[model samples]
Target: MTGDFTARVTALLMPHLILAPIALPMLTAGLMLLLREERQRTKVAMNVVSTFLGLVVAVLLLVQAKQPGVQTSLGVYLPGNWPAPFGIVLALDRLSAMMLVLASTVALATVLFSAARWHKAGVHFHPLFQFQLMGLSGAFLTADLFNLFVFFEIMLAASYGLLLHGSGRPRVAAGLHYIAINLAASSLFLIGVSMLYGITGTLNMADLARGIAGIDPSDRGLLHAGAGILAVAFLIKAAVWPLNFWLVPAYSAATAPVGALFALMTKVGVYSILRLWTLMFSSGAGDSAQFGSQWIVGAGLVTMCFGALGMLGSQRLGHLAGYAAILSSGTLLAALGFGQNLLTAGLLYYLLGSTLAVSAMFLLTDLIERWRNDGASLAPHEQTDDAPFLAADLVHTQGLNLDEKEEVLIGQVIPAAVAFLGLAFLACTLVIAGLPPLPGFVGKFAMIHALLNPLGLGSSGGFVLGSGGWALLALMVGTGLLALIALTRAGIRHFWASHDRAAPKLLVLEGLPIALLLTGCALLAWQAGAVMRYTQATADALHAPGTYVQAVMSARPVPNSPGTAPGANGRPQ
Candidate 1:
């Protein structure tokens, strides 16, 4: 009987696995709170198992999302069984599922990486980590504005603890700044959400889209005001320049695993803009159609340029990674503004590859810096380090060091750890720099192709590019070049400038996450064809807002259990 009960429970829960990505971590985190501090091993085990299970569920959802057809592929789960617009709804579609997979993948890898030593830095690390995942999952899956705010707060709240996980004066300072900025943003979030709800009777995103389309012309100004305020909150989170001063210091100060996972935080902002803008302002939205497209595109271009310049100005690996992330956000935001379906597809592809590369870069920075610290350090202008920096040092090439330096030009043995880090760094640089022969290059190429040849990819109609097209093309290439130069400069400084290099002690746990992230980048590049097809479909679905609305708005509440009348308990007749 017990076995039968267990089997039945499993069967029952299987259908609700759509909610598992969000709910699993919440339950796991709650259960973990009961454990004693001395049982850190158990906490770690629970954290890892829960994260791995979340990854499995994410992959399962991705498979379902990939199945062809709108109604079939778009999975909607009403938590309260009260239908959309009336109660909480969780959505699983191509876009949200992809984000779930990405979040879970990063979460599992970072948890494993932290297991090496980082998680021990602070109290409640395990629970905070799980809560962070829960927030990320919910933000992606939530089908309404209010729940998005709740999840955003959940994410930011947990990040507050994670940011200061390994506390130092610098970390505390940066974390405080991060918290203050986000808190302000959250206030704006609440105000905007409230305005939206007040203006329209519902906070459901799908219903909001439907309402916005038929909204009176006089209220358009108020509507735009609320959305603009909401966009500011997202832009702040996305680290759009001038508003991004806090990001580098905070992220750089985070522990390695935390820093890596924090890479997804900015993307959540980008994802929100993508979901709402596409749904609420599509071609079918009448007057609101493409309303803020120009402004977003302009913001994106400026952000891209600012990020590239910031990268060039950055002197450290952590700073470089932070700026690289900002650059990615700009690129994605800019692509979304272009209002082309094929461009959107390429942007999604780029988003995945760039996210992997940036996350790996964050992890790599800690390892490389640790290794550099273990090595003998010399001032760049100091007489001993001339060969690595001076063009004269390049011209004065000699088989023997002029001073018989410790670094031998003739077959110096590199530690396996050093070699591994170097290769990973190289991969990250290529992808983040958007260089050739990788998905980074392929994704951009696809975007440019779609831009120059809209008809090439089956777009519904063409829009005039004016001077925007030329400017975007120029910026795309220009930023890539700037990124390449900046990363290459940093690479030489870290890997080549020093004499008597040493490798830090590395654990499998520490190394595995970086390796897996880099490997994922490679896989994306290798499977670009299949990946693009999937992204193309996603882009197509995103451009078609009506389908999304129909799916969500048409959903009816689950029926009452047997013996209950249809109209019982105030149920709709």
Candidate 2:
């Protein structure tokens, strides 16, 4: 009886388990909508439970993804028992599973952080939060371009609410700009998707991969055009230079928790790029292999340089974090442009570590600024008759002072709170600067090592350190130095420059989540070997598009009735 019960439980959950990541938050959001507005605590409890369950489900999926028997993307779920390329499908692979895990972790952290105050700042906060998670999870797990678009809209709509939560004039203005740019990008998304369908007759990514190689020579130009247009939309969303002006302003204006969540948003665009490029333009695609590679590298290099410089000039910590996000995106794009499996492996690890650190930076920025708002700033603001050390705002003119307020007071609760903030800020600095003994340093070191010694890591062949590799290596080191100098200077100003320093009251909810995210970085460092192995395996799978195509296109629909579907189909739905 116990064995029977265990078997029954496994049968019920295992088949549909992949859907849980996407479905749980969606159901939670709907349930939250049903609750009356007065039961705020109940709503909070529901949100937390749902998010925690989603994270648990994501981890389980990751474990299954690593299981044997599949070339890639372990679990493929077709809604309503429809076949692939004909119906909505959600699939999981090492890469997608990793992303799902990352998104869920960020969701849990931000939600926990919000519980302190941000959630209660506006109505419908709980529902919107769940909706955002639903969208993010769906985006990561989706198997087709159409569903990807749908999830993007879902995510953006919720972000529209979250970004403008506790609306003020600053938020309103930034929110409007954010909404307008994304709306335009969404338009481009539709246009590009339509073009791809017109050319290939399918919107399923795996299907496209299989179909693109067999297309007529005459349609090659159109295919590239369609993909280029689509890339423009992604590039805009990813905050590449020349189209990234909205990122810093919009991200900086958001509340702490919302801003922390937004840390993962740009990565979605980067993920989209990675997914499409690998599937459609991998080395196997004959003439189309590595299409537009140079442009991607150029854009990434420009964005990295821009972000590094912008960060140096930033007086506000919020802006610094925003610029750091742009820098991370650029790094991924540039590394990915190389199209080497080992390089891809390193960047994947970098992506995870950098995103966590950047999210922590956003949270810490809010805390430090709050201290300034509470008149506990250690730095002097403006010129005084006796001593005028001159703050950054005074030195760089008023333009650098986006929202830095000048206040001064010494308070009692200084020793402990200030120490915590100081240590957290220092960790953020170390991570951002790619200093030793953190996952950030490990990630960068891995990428550089892979680039310089591809054959040393059991590679099947040799790689040339071309001009591009040299350039990337130089920028990686240079940017780290710049970040260290800028962040260290900001730390000194925030923690020691002024005599009116004090510790402001930090809620347990607020401090705990920040510590949790940083602790994640610590764990990543401690387990770097295992994490790197997983990432390397993921990269190997991604570079082989044929495996992805075979897996996705061969997936069949689950039969509901004898006549509805065939039972002997490939990759049981």
Q: Which candidate is the best by lDDT?
A: 1
Candidate 2 residue-wise lDDT, 1-573, digit = tens: 999999999876686788887778888889889989889999989988898898899899888888875433346776656677887778888898899899888888888888888887888999999898888888888989999999999999999999999889989999999999999999999999999999999999999988777888999999999999999999998999989999999999999989999999999999999999999998778789889888898899889899899899999999999999999999889888877888888899989988988998898888889887775334355336533335534544644332244422322245677888899888888888888898889988988988897666555232467888888999999998998888999999988765464466788988888898899889889999999999989988888867777777777665455654643332335
lDDT of 1 by residue, 35-131 (tens): 9877899999999999999999999889877776534334777677677798887877899999998998888889999999888998999999999
Worst 10 residues of 2 by lDDT: 403-412
Cα lDDT for residue 69, candidate 2: 53
Q: How many times do residue backbones clash in model 2?
A: 1
Judge candidate 2 against the unseen true structure and give its global Cα lDDT, from 0 to 1: 0.85
Steric clash pairs (candidate 1) = none
lDDT at residue 87 of model 1 (Cα atoms): 84
